[model samples]
Target: MHQILLIRHGEAAKSPTDADPGLTPLGQRQAETLADDLDRQFPGGEGVRLVSSPKTRARQTAIPVAGRWQARVDEQHNVIEIPSPEGMPLAERGQWIRTLLKSRWDTLSPAQGNWREDITDYLLQLASTRDEGRFHTTLVFCHFMVINSVVAAIRNDLQVVQFYPDYASQTHLAIDDGKLHLVQLGQETNIGSLIQ
Candidate 1:
């Protein structure tokens, strides 16, 4: 079986209007603490692969863990946050995301549906491939919705939002015999803002 850890990115310093924002000070500290926790779980980061979404916050969240493991992080566009509609103003993105959170996967726009499919396919491909003597566990630093997407898919649920994953929270999954299974849900938080 292949193990996958889906880690939500740390809190962003700026609002969602900024397009791409780095982490807050507290978020950076959270990342550090997460690194320590992961180190205890997988000492020296042996037999592990590090991956991060291309977004700034996700990339920033992976820094400490990458440093701890002395490993290079592979930036993956497929694991990025859910896309906003074309021509949607940055200021309006928060409201859009809030609405999206209440939506079902079957109701997604064509682009959004495509995005979900791409991410799911990418993860399945990753899990099915074996690297001989290399990594067995993949640490993916990604966004809130991305984690939810994978979890919802695995559970065969249509909901757009499965569970609320907090900053630096880790959701575990296992893949075996070409199937995905949920090992554990991540730590959840009840937050008002989906774009925070």
Candidate 2:
């Protein structure tokens, strides 16, 4: 089985001014701890691949783990935070996201539904293995919504807010027979500030 670890990026600076804010000081420490944990599990980073969202915080979070594993982080566009409406300010993004999470995916507007499908399909595509003999794992550093959406897809649950993934949390999945199965859900708590 190929393991997929959905890791949430560490806490980010919630600033309306900065469009893509980097991790906060505390977040840096969290990333280092996460790296240490990963190294302990897969010493020397053997049999592990690192992937990250194309966002400042997610990239930052992936750095130490990639460095330890001697692998580069493959940045993925689809693993990014859910997009807000055009011209939606950072401060107001949280409210919009909160509203979106309240409704089920089937009840969402066409565009929103398409966005969900795009993310789900991209993840399933990644959870693949052409070699049957080799077993490997991929660690994905991404945002809260990104993790939640994938978990929701695996469970076939329509509710977008399947669970809240805290910073550095890892959701474990196993891919076998061309299907992604949830092995574990990440540590979660209702965190405020949706733009994270």
Candidate 3:
């Protein structure tokens, strides 16, 4: 069985106009704490693969973990954030995302559906190809929607939003016999009116 850990990036320095934002001070601290916790759980990072979305926040979150494990992070565009509609202003993205949360996967536009499929396909490919006689764990540092997409696909749920994952939370999954199974959902936080 191959293990997959989907980690959400820490709190970002969200800005209305900024298309890409990095982590805040607290978020950086959170990333360090996460690195320590993960290092203790998987000593020396043996048989571990580090992956991160190309997005700034996700890359930032993976840095400390990479340092702790002495591993390089492979940046993947397939694991990046869900795409907003064309011509949508950056400031209006949050509202669009809020609306998307209320919808179902089958109801998504073609582009969105394609994005979801790509994420699942990429993960399945990773899970299928593993070292012989060794159990490998892949650490995917990604965005909220990316994690939600995987969880929803495994559970066979049609909802666009499965559950709210807290910053730096890790959701566990296992791939056995060409099937993906959810071991556990990540920590959740109730941030009323704050969607980031």
Best by TM-score: 1
Pairs that collide in candidate 3 are none
Worst 10 residues of 3 by lDDT: 126-135
- lDDT (C-alpha, whole model) for all candidates: 0.88, 0.82, 0.88
TM-score per candidate, chains pooled: 0.96, 0.90, 0.95
Q: Looking at candidate 1, what is the lDDT of residue 54?
A: 95
What is the per-residue lDDT of model 2 for residues 147-196, given as tens digits with 9 covering 90 to 100?
Answer: 87788888998888888888899999887777789999988856573457
Candidate with the larger TM-score of 1 and 3 = 1
- Writing each residue's lDDT as its tens digit, candidate 3 over 53-92 gives 9989999999998987789899999999999988888999
State the lDDT at 39 in candidate 1. Answer: 97
As for candidate 2, its clashing pairs are none
lDDT of 1 by residue, 1-196 (tens): 7889999998887675589989999889989999999999999999999999999999999999899889999999999999989899989998888888898999988998899889878877776555735878989999999999899999899998899999999999987888778999999977742465
What is candidate 1's local distance difference test score? Answer: 0.88
Higher-lDDT candidate of 1 and 2: 1
lDDT of 2 at 58: 96
